[model samples]
Target: MTSGFWQKTGKGLAKTRHFLSAGLGSIFKKKREIDQDTFDRLEALLIGADLGVEVTQVLLADLKASVERKEVGNLETLRDKLKTSLIEILKQVPVAPPIDESPIVTLFVGVNGVGKTTTIGKHAKRLCAEGKKVLLAAADTFRAGAGEQLSIWGQRAGAEVIRFPPGADPSAVVFDATSAAMARKVDHLLIDTAGRLQTKHNLMEELKKMTRVISKQIPNAPHEKILVLDATTGQNALSQAEHFQKAIGLTGIVLTKLDGTGRGGIVVPIVQKFSVPIIEIGVGESPEDLIPFDIENFVGALFEEENP
Candidate 1:
């Protein structure tokens, strides 16, 4: 990662960093001894950071038990311990392998307004920059202007976008896009699906249909099913992940809008509950703002530690 990447990540997580430093700084300004009250207050602070009650309790228990064993003595050491614990939880999802297959098919899923289309665009740009011939499938015909939105992004990313008339069958779009990808021998095919509410069973079933279409068109196609989530949504994002997993199993997640929210800690519970590898995080509005999820940079940025 570049130095700018680390700097931007630190800036993106400034809100959460302030939250953590403030809570810990107050508790351990001049360390005397760890006590029951200290533990209780620590639990409250973590819970307030949107770690979720269960996860906070689990982490607090681990840290307190370590203190009993004399593993962590002062605030600075305890801070390091907490950082390590969080990183362990984040590491539950392993790193993804490089895209090696020709015309790799990827499907993007999520509710509306979660930056689903934007994530697709940013990734398409990255792939193109890598000299890959990328094609975008606008399978989001359900929404007005969805096709145009992707077309704009395609122009910016220097990729061709496959689409149909507004309100056309989304399956048809995927089928045609797959055929184009094969005929052109493109390196990657990114399908941008319409945003569907999880509670709407019919809409979710539609997503399943589209998934089937992609697989039928190309064996082992839709090779990647990525769920795009809004970080600012807090626990609501986790609920979205759960509901989408039931509808269409997610292979990974793209967490967006982390630049300005103290709720970035929500990433911990999302990964813990779903075990979904977070592919990347949207830190800002630019195409380059979409940075790959690096555990060290993420933790370091959030805690103001040197990027490892």
Candidate 2:
């Protein structure tokens, strides 16, 4: 069955399109030039667009080369070139594994309050609707009410939730959950991890334990380690990504809160600097609001309305 992202991402698409339109819209305003003024304008626009300094510089350097050769002339060529470059960059992220197999485990990690738990719930619901047997492990045992919240989501999503009392050993919960999943032959096992600062060794240790415990049941069972990030955090998102990746090794990133703020450009720098695959974006709070990251749809959504 088709997912909800393809349907409700229109608003996110619009937000992204609006930003992209503003960025590329200016590039074609005047006759193409190889002068420093042209370079400065483009650079400033991208940086202001929140693409980050490094990404802006790299993109600007490439644009400079094209301008010197007069390869980028008008709006059409500029838009196409931008889209192609972004697509090439995004193509590096492999498509997520299909969920047809049983007992697939996904470990969710990120800093506090990045919507990690909510993302897990949404994912569980989606998998359930697809007719897959899904289970949720509330391994975020350090936080108060985290277990109950996940249990609520379990009921809402119609999936079983395995949780321990607050302050219980998270690894034990995961160990039990994995065993339950295997015994039931479930399709997917999504583990909700604690949201701790990357600097916290104890919390990071907990994550490593979660991974180690899962390995016991299914070798390298946590097939996907998704880092959920707050898009509204902007550049702070990059720092969080760096720390989280270093600590637990992020397999992908889930950018949350894209629907509220205009800071969607965080996607560019996060990918450019870290090379972490952006698997999904949280546009809004609805269970259906999380969208798979699509470069073209994203770029098109960012620039659909305006032209130079």
Which is the leading candidate under lDDT?
Answer: 1
Tens-digit lDDT track of model 1 for 1-308 = 88988878888787888887788778876566888878888888887778888789889989989999999888878888888999999998866677677889999999998998999999999999999999999999988999999999999999999989998999899989999999999999999998988899999999999889888978787889999998888888878999999988988999998987886888889889988888899988889989988888898787773333
- TM-score of the candidate numbered 2? 0.90
Q: Report residue 285 deviation for candidate 2 (angstroms).
A: 0.5
In candidate 1, stretches whose alpha carbon ends up further than 4 angstroms from where it belongs are 305-308
- Give the whole-model CA lDDT for all candidates, comma-separated: 0.88, 0.80
Q: Show pairs that collide, candidate 1.
A: none
Local lDDT at 296 for model 2:
68
Please give the lDDT score for candidate 1. 0.88
Best by TM-score: 1
